[model samples]
Target: MIIRTRAGALATTAVLAVTGGLLTATPAAAASVCSSPKWRVQFYANTTLSGTPKATFCESALNQNYGLGDPPGVTLPKDNFSARWTLTRDFGSGGPFTFTAESQDGVRVYVDGVRKIDAWRNVTATQRRTLNLSLPAGSHTIRVDFAAWTGAANVKFTYAPRTASTVDKVRPLAPTGPSVSYDRTVNRATLLWLRNKEMDIAGYRVYRRPATSTAWSRVSGTGLVTSDTYANLPPATGETYLYEVRAVDKAGNESTGSADRSVVSVDRTRPASPTGLTGADARGGVTLRWTAVPDAARYTVFRQKRPVNGEIQPVVEAATVTSPTWTDTTAPERADYTYSVSAVDAAGNASVRSADLTVTRGDHPPAPPTGVTTADSRYGVHLQWSGSTSDDVAGYRLYRDGELAVDRIDRAVDDTTRPYTFAYEDRNARYGTTYEYVVAAVDRSGNETRAAAVTHTTPGDRVPPAVVTGLTATPREDGVLLEWEPNQEPDLKRYDVYKATWLGDGPIGSEDGAWAIGQIAWLNETDTSYLHKATPEGETVLYAVVATDDWGNSRAPHTGQEFAWVTVTELGTPTEG
Candidate 1:
């Protein structure tokens, strides 16, 4: 809503004056004039009398008869010359909208940068009109000049996009898809088909078929009427059935039939308990979550204002989704929405509505919660989420290997760290031994979700040692100079060198029930090379570095000691580091 100040009118005569008689030669491509519009009082002389008999509106509301010959005894209406235009076609967008008005004398239609009718002229009021206007989708501007021609005149113009839907084409009208419902009283079934885009869309048809048979029977009345509900459906009194629908246009154009909507027409009485119900304002959208029923084809989600009557609840937003979730961005702000959901069977019958849920949206995000999953023999089990974004999360907390570990924080996980990752070498368990794990996300709020459980077997942890660089074991004066190029991880926290007599023998960290042993002694500092104390007496001390990087991610064990060629001389008690 804006007010436009009237400048004046630019008649076709001005084009001749500016370009020196260039009547048809590209009138200097003036800017569109819809950008600026003017309003004025007008007179619609119904009765063809003499002087101004009555005025619908005038230049000014008070100046009823300033120029016309109307006296003070006559009352006049306010200036009624106003109109909002819609574009039929536009040259470009954004306007230097320039238009021209052609009136003999006493009238003018203001356009951009042009003025014609200075004073009244007695000449015939005839002028070829042209308007250059910037055309936007919705509202626009129009120009008209109908001054006192024989006592009165009529004001009229035409435009497009009379309604909001005419401009926004993405609006969805009726629900589409196979729908089924069941009835209880007669043990019958009812099918519903909806095909609607605009209020002008016609109606729908319902096709019925039994679960055991392949043939279908089309109900009466080619769906050309006003209603879509099909009555007296399959009277099997609790039989599963299938149904489908097609839409017909006003001109008798019938669209292809929709996919079948399957149903079971359960007890046809009360609906089964609705499950997986949850609510949240997620990722800038309102989401209602639910678990899907195994045999149901569609979940009927209903929304309405606070209940008003005693029997039926007012339904506002009724929509369906492929899965169990329904989203509504149209929910009003600061207002509560009551929702009820029902499962519709393949037999064209719907269960009674579930109890309503009142949901509200808040401004803040819910705190991060803890959860976990497991992958057999894989350190990383994968992480999933259910809560809101964190405002001050430094990183996350990973729990594994019988202990809690930190993976990432205010810092994001590098190519190295991951979620659901265990930080310990519990690989010693027998192949079928079950291992436990969990993960938790820590936010600036220090709040966390309950830890989730993950159970998996170690599958003998037999994956070959993953060495990044080369691996080699050389015999040296210090029993065995068991050295290896350390993993190049700056997050290298520490390294535990393992020594086993045989390549396939038990690892040095095997406990009572575990074959992996922790006896190999060269615990080298994370930053230095190592010469394991006096080579233990055998072809075994197969050295491998379990490098723990700085961020607490341990490099998978890599073997360096090729014990097949090296032999160690017995040392003092063969002490372990």
Candidate 2:
């Protein structure tokens, strides 16, 4: 529970005129007027608060101390006097609250005219009284009364709402008198409303919606507005929009929305520019097409002629159309021109022009190439196609995997049987890889027609790598160290070392079967040397090396002078023992 002191002095004073060392003949009339949301108070000459008040002024709170002296701006005696403070304020969706009062003499508290706390007894020290109560929603009046019979005199009273969400489930009242004003120069709408009366109000939420829409959007963002005013920038489309505000309490409960306010926004927004504009020469004329723009009612096309030399002609309006496509039958034949487009809305606002497109009038693209075929070979991928039937066809272009691979090819077979036949081999293509090829035909005017496309996967490599050469073996105290030249094949996988024991021989024969051959070591493609540590001393050993490819193809192992043979020596001997 939180307790707040509603403490302040009198807000207004009633002047009692005194003339010529004597008081005025007319007594000052009692006037009770306090600023909004402040307490109204009255002071009496008697402790019973009977008869007319000696002074009636406004106070912000009931806290006061007049120790052996009269109250300020009042004629009440120092002792045997009384004062009362009262106010009627909205509690909104009220919940639990704590009321407290402290006094040196006597004090009492009342809510809506019903007594809630009473400490009506004279005391030498200040006496305190507190009580908890559940308040209902809406406006209620609170009153505090204090009397001093003798000695020091002081009194204080305060009340606060319990804002715990679990204990306070009441929602605040809706904001009142919501109004809006629009500034056409800045395209902004300012909204103002009366603040909620709830003491526990957290903040306000402002919402907006188009006049034609039933859905509302929260324009205040994720956070609540702590002020009574808000500014929003609605679309300046000359449309009418509505706005409303709601009050939120500390418990997170929101009230009903306030009355809707309307504003007419200025029309300053323009339609979006056209996009994806394309122009092509056709039999009738030059045709232009573009993507439609949202909220656009029509479109305008602009054109300019391209000269062979010097600066291009000035751009001029070509046509106005409602649809996204238009044809210019006025364009002359065999001429080059550039075109652009812009979109217009119903409000007569025109957007920026679209990107320019160049087209040659009466110059049509050649027909696409046909009879496209692909074949896999050991060399690479093979592509074959027939030329376009169009007489204006100048050359051909090839695209591999959507990228231009061959820029131009002018040569074609001159044979009468297949006069337009063409073939191309892609030597850079790798084996066991897939490729997509496209064949296009170009016209004299540089217009290319996308043509036949073919997909092919090359066969896997089956050839073995070259035999290992320059192999050398040196007998050491630990073992025989063997080395060889590395193979250059791209698909080489690894190398294998073979060793055989020569029982009795000057030179080992290729077909010798008495000596068993065993692979002593398998090294990766990058390794070019190996050390055989398991060789027996005093025995002649033949070492052979072979290269293998990724496809499991290996060179045949050979035993000759190329394959070194050395006799193992003792630990300290340089020659065979």
Candidate 3:
């Protein structure tokens, strides 16, 4: 319980008063107020006395006690008690006494028969007064009023000297904030708190004990500081600690102990290594499974990317519940990968990592597509392929302008997409401009192979078949002239020209493909030229060719040179188409 007084001071315990008294008490010794009653007083030379009174009283001297008495029955006055003292205790020097009569009971202290302490009641209640005698420091007669009673009679009293020892005062501060907390890294408990408002503080003392124990002893203190921190405390290993702090002020005053707190510190040691790690299929990715260690809080999985030559640095993708299984969701296909696992305790301490488990699966890359690459638009492009993704391919790929344009499975499927296409819509591309293009193939194993291409660009985002090279058509007197520069391709295979009355500038692959006028087959890899004859005069002629590599790479149809325009002496102006 807390005790509070009207003075606003509070404490845990209250001071009790002694009750009852003993009879027939003997007066053992007597003493004086000043040093041996050598009434230290001062007297002025020419101060005359007033009021006519008998000289038997000690007066007109330095009077110390002038009033100590009961009130008259005539009036109910306030508590007015004083001792007139013109006396000074100057460790050594003495001087004159200028005095007056101020008393309580009938006057008993007087000088020259003049009463100083006035009291009309009998049995004085400890009346005291002093006067100046102008005497030396040796000794002097100072009288006291002995009336002890004011109303009902009791025992009389007198004045005596009592030695008083100085009082002790205290001002101490208490520690604040969370006194204790767990240290996750070291698996230990750390205690921290602050001290403030310590006035005249000499030092602080800390005392602590186990919750189950009652004995508390001093632990430590830095004498003075606003705060303190302690860590790595295995004090009593697994038990809780209760602490209190006391402050000692400079004047030997001690403040009572502050509030106490019981703190529990955990031991949080790490768990055992995980076991039985196995891999299984989780959808398209591999699922890694492991046994959870007892007392383990979480598990972490790592992925190791197989390097070209050096050792691989394992990477931890995530940590999860100790169920100990993780789906390798980011697994890469057709490549070697390694893995490892570890167990983490509640304190975040991790166990030694498990042994490395590795697997080598696949190493194949996609086969190169046998196709002709050409730029066909400001961003439009074309590719013609003649190969499959496998000797037994699930699909074949055709790319235009270096982007995948076709993915078809089966040779029969390849035959249907004879012409592959791509159209770029980049805002930064220009119309009627030149660009380069290439094509690569991706296999069933997610592997990509390099390009098989022909370099040819069009007047407007189109590339002609280079294997066809050049061509011309003219109507002569005897017949029509049809000529073509054989494909410069070292693997030139064949050529074919189509003839009809064409409507647009599009090449042979476009709509309205006309009839074939002639076809030529190449016999040598060094063949750089070819020519064909037209079946009729004034006919529109379009030609295209194919170049086949040892690996079956091919080219697409493209516009040959425009040579069908008529030139004649009869017509001075040449007819242009």
Candidate 4:
């Protein structure tokens, strides 16, 4: 509840004096004066009633009587005397009111800056005249003028509400503090205003007009007697509307309209969901289709990648189209992708997602293997080559001597390094056998690339190479450096160094299959030294070496030559000096 101080009115009265001589007359007897609120009264000694007055004071009422006589300190003429009264007061509530002016000569009256009565003339006897009025609840000013041109000089005035009769002559007060509110979901607008306090208030009338038009149309019913609030008024979405209100009394009198307020209605309802969503795989793309939705301004496309590792989840908006069909030209072949569509209304409301459609791109072959090479042994051959770098490459296919030896070689076969390459050991060949090896990469779509072929010939039977000896490990600034005596075999192809966490149970060290041949390539078998950099810290390291002859026979366990080892205890990550 809000309270406000009622503004008070400023009351002021002025009396002007004129150059008129006083009139002589015998003292006259007094008559009864009307009873009413006090009024500022002044008497002038001339008919024109101009200039300073002979008598001025606050009169208890407008009624007064003097008969051809003079009062004790007064010297005003009785025949041509004039009088005026002014009153300023608050009416509290606006309603129909009446005013009566009785005078022996002529009289005039004014209310709230408006002249309501005028009968200024000469007359023989006191004649009474009445005025019907409707006054709004606020401060008002009333003024009366009278002239006594004859014997007995007298005047009186009175007023009251004319609500029960046909005296109403004024309109009700205008309502204040008008406001408007709209609900987007319901498309309804409500109007409210300050209540009218007029005693004879019958009801209020509500009106509205488009913001762009000046013609107002009534919104409320005939007589809204109980509520100052009008609700459930339909307003077009996206359009501006203005509202105003006016007060009316039981006598059908109406005040001016209140100030107009405006609001723009919004559309918040979502469009219907897209239906019949379908998709098909096209050349290098995916084509999607769906049924058109009523009132849908556009359609939005969303995509979700395959649920495999690293895929974006829940999908996201991809594109907006006015039509019901869309093509995803950027979809990659042989990859899993799912699509969905949604309809959007003019107000930016999007419908729920349509059913999902999954697609796998068309087939595309893997790239060819590069750098193919082979090493021959007394029995079979060994192959090493670079693997395919394509994301869809599933494995390799190996062909030997113009025949397929491995149809599907899983990429995991070479798990020794990141981005593993292809390596194989062919142990099915007889001595002196000539062979041609070819390798090709296959994709997940079953497409294979052109093979890269290499030729090799197995060596004739010969004695195995001598064992490598005198192996030693010495600590260096970078890491442990290993040294060993060269093998006695004149056809030694290379030397391979092996390391492990020396469990110390067998000639090859502890046998948990922790054996791995270091990647270092020793082209010269006579070069019997190797440096191991950045070895794992806080562990005993074991080192061993095997000598390989041109026939691919390693002089260790392969040829019954027990491997000799050198051990370094507590090796730390090497540091630069």
Candidate 5:
């Protein structure tokens, strides 16, 4: 049960009592009156304290005790006695107040003759009863009845408010007419809100929260800003911001927030152009690489194509990526191709195209490497392929389930003309999982032969993987680098890394907090770390990991006891690969 009372210091409990018999006669009026606001007291016979009082007088306060003794004036029974006290006064405006009444035998209180509290009962100890009342403006009568059938006789009455003040009773209404206008030329946003109509309002305060963030912050530094208009706010570029205003009264009561307004500040400045564009003509595709561009959200590749016999056009868009490397697998065989890259900011502003790089495919492409095979064991998938027999052959590239699993073969060969054996272990492949594999043979002149595909299904392994630990994330200019202690489970296939844009109090897939966007990257069982090079700058990124067994069973990162989590702010300098 909730009890609401006026604001004031808490008061101590009151105790009172009366009994079966009272003094038989009245006492002479004391020479001195019972102070200013005294209480009219009366004593009566019978345990119910019914009929009229056998003795009458006035007391300055309720603090009273009548031990084993006769009445000072008239004679009356001592053991069983009853008494009643009445006080009347005019209290101001209606408000929450507390009324406390105590007694040794029994006691009850009445406001304006209406029962407000009742604790009447026979007892060896003093009993106390407190009642909170909302008194109206006017004169009211307060009466307390007490009885003492045995033992000690005592009675006390007191009351006080509960809260420090009644200001909380009033709340300012929400602000209206909220609006935001952004000036692109001046690069500032002006906010306007209707002034609160509350008479006691001290001032207004503005709050701002970034569109991508869940936290809110006060925008004003000075206390109680009285202005209804906030001008010249330079919000962050390339982001949308939310704003609201709240009114605070002089009594320190704050009203609900006003309707929110949102504004988008587009970043019009272009990013630095990517440099060092170079292309290598290889079998089946062209491989391109470039130096990283600072503050570039992503790199857009443009291919220079000749639609007519003589006219050259560089309008053909290729691909976009945070990584600096890209492979064009659709380049026509034995054809010349020119490519260039341009940096794009988050606001879609593009920089000038980098220098052009041209590469001509060789006339004779390398022969397709034959005899591709895979061995699926409980550990992982083991792949083997035959080297190309052409003299211009460079090395092989491997693909898993049609995805570029390995960009290039790691083994070094002294001669390209002779057929040789190439091997790779796909330790990250889970057991009980079927996978398709393909290998391509490329030559020095950027010529290539189509590779034959191979399929293999791993044997099932039921052992669960161990939880990953030592997770650490390092911020970089281009992205976030994550590393963790490798799992020791022999059947561990690979590690799946998950990222969350926000961590506290959010909605996830079927969960209420820590929503995982998706798997950011996968790592081999032996690999301890991975790098993400395209995260947004000035934002914190949260990461978690899960280790999967050969049979596809997984162990998620421990969220308790020892939670494996890493946070990094996007502030790293570009470390181009």
Candidate 6:
């Protein structure tokens, strides 16, 4: 008989029993002939079920009908026969279950020998009964009894689990008989396990972990697997990995893991090649660097001397290090070499070599310019220095006040000779300002030497203003009006005016002579015109103007012949001055 529980239907065997007493069995009855667990059935000739069973065998289900006829494998009075079915099996984490039965005449159900369903009355139509009960975890037994008294004969009994998540709180039993197989050609592992007996089982989950690690990782996909087998690709690093399976139920509850199955994988993959290789000539050695490779246990650096005149050199191992940088202190000076790097894993698999990098050793900066000197003049500051003695010197660089004033100055042809001299004029320098100058020598390789520096202050302005031009004297009644073009000197202090008397035949007063008026008026730099008032009437007056600077350096005054002379008439009208 297939008895339905909340989890699923379970096939059971029958044990003959009297209506009011337990039936005895021989020792051979303990051994069942069924391939799989099934319902063991027996038929009795009497309705009270009081004698040896006429037939004994196993059937997958209890549903049967015999209308006015006898059941198969038995000869009985079609209307007064009895049958029974029973089974004992594990109910892993059992929970609430419902038992249902329908039969003609009478039928009853029991759990662990306790009567749970009773409908023991003969009926013309099929009688039905259902009972709900809680089944604890572990082994349990179920029994069903049916009797046919008259007319049609039939019986059906089944039970199932209450699969509702809120109703069934028990978890499914753990999957068992787990086994794993590995394929070295593909680096993959396949796991298999016996399915759990729980009919409400949703699926199974497969888990894996390194044999040395305590943590486990789900190898199956995110969704629960609905099959008893799984396939996954484990890392092929020559390490042992453990695999297990777990059962999940429709209620979303999961059981404990099954026994662990382990497999050792073969390693054939190599680490990735290192990249971004570069090299530089350092003070202590030839330093090389490259990008780090994942899963690399160490890096190997290889180098070979550059071909000279088409002659190739054999490559040699430089160094093996765990970091991304290495220094070869034994590298010879003044040589060119090509370098490459490779990564190696713990399994001794080496990756392909990285792209090669070319480097030159013994590259040093040229010597700095020496004998630096500075001199200030009225125009600007002047800088002079001796060229560097180094033959590889490409040019010199100049800096003013810590800023680059000149990018480069080509080396002169005479720079190779003794007493090398170079000069640069900084016209941008201002008067009375202090400045710091630095000079360095650069080589073709872009290496620069220590700068030679000097600090100096520019001299103050001592230059005088230029002579004034466009001097004119207009004869006005009040005085001789004078105006002249303004001087453009930034340091001009003022203008000085002088007056002299002119006779009818010759000039009487001169700028440097005793007959001249020494000075008449002093005007500020912005005042270019001056009015000399109250001059002698009907007389010729001589005028002169000169420019002076802030340092008291004045322009030479006009001589007698150059003075502006103007004659006045009795009406006070000036002729010319």
Give the per-residue lDDT of model 4 (tens digit) for 288-356: 899999888999999988876775666777789999998876565767888889899888888998888
Candidate 3 lDDT, 1-577, residue by residue in tens: 1111222321112222222321111111221133432342211111122222101111223322322211111111112221222212221111234333333343345433345444434434533344443323222344433222233221121222111113223233444453666664464555565543332355556677888898987666444422465543546344577766665554544455667766665645456777777776422356788877876778887777678568655575544656777766445555666777888877687777777677553444544555454445434444444553333234555444566545543334335453332222323334344544444555555566655555554443223235444545445444444455655644344444333344545654487454443334443455544433323344444444444443344443333343232221111233569
Q: What is the TM-score of each candidate against the true structure?
A: 0.21, 0.55, 0.24, 0.35, 0.27, 0.52
RMSD of each: 29.8, 23.4, 22.1, 17.8, 38.4, 17.8
Give the number of the best model, judged by TM-score.
2
Model 6 / residue 83 / CA error / Å? 0.7
lDDT of 1 by residue, 219-240 (tens): 6454444666666456343556
| Whole-structure CA lDDT of model 2 | 0.79
Return the top candidate by lDDT: 2
lDDT of each: 0.45, 0.79, 0.44, 0.72, 0.71, 0.77
Worst window of 10 by summed lDDT in candidate 1: 57-66
Which tens-of-lDDT digit does each residue in 93-209 have in candidate 2? 778888989897989899999999999988898899989888998889998888989888888888888788887777788899999999989999999999888888889999999
Off by over 4 Å in 5: 1-171, 232-238, 269-286, 289-342, 350-577
Each candidate's clash count: 52, 0, 55, 8, 30, 19
User: lDDT tens digits, residues 405-443, model 6?
Assistant: 998987454556653778888999876689999988887
Q: Order the candidates by lDDT, highest first — what do you get?
A: 2, 6, 4, 5, 1, 3
C-alpha RMSD of candidate 2: 23.4
lDDT pick, better of 2 and 6: 2
Regions more than 4 Å wrong, model 6: 1-36, 211-215, 268-298, 304-335, 351-358, 363-577
- Residue 293, model 3: lDDT of 85
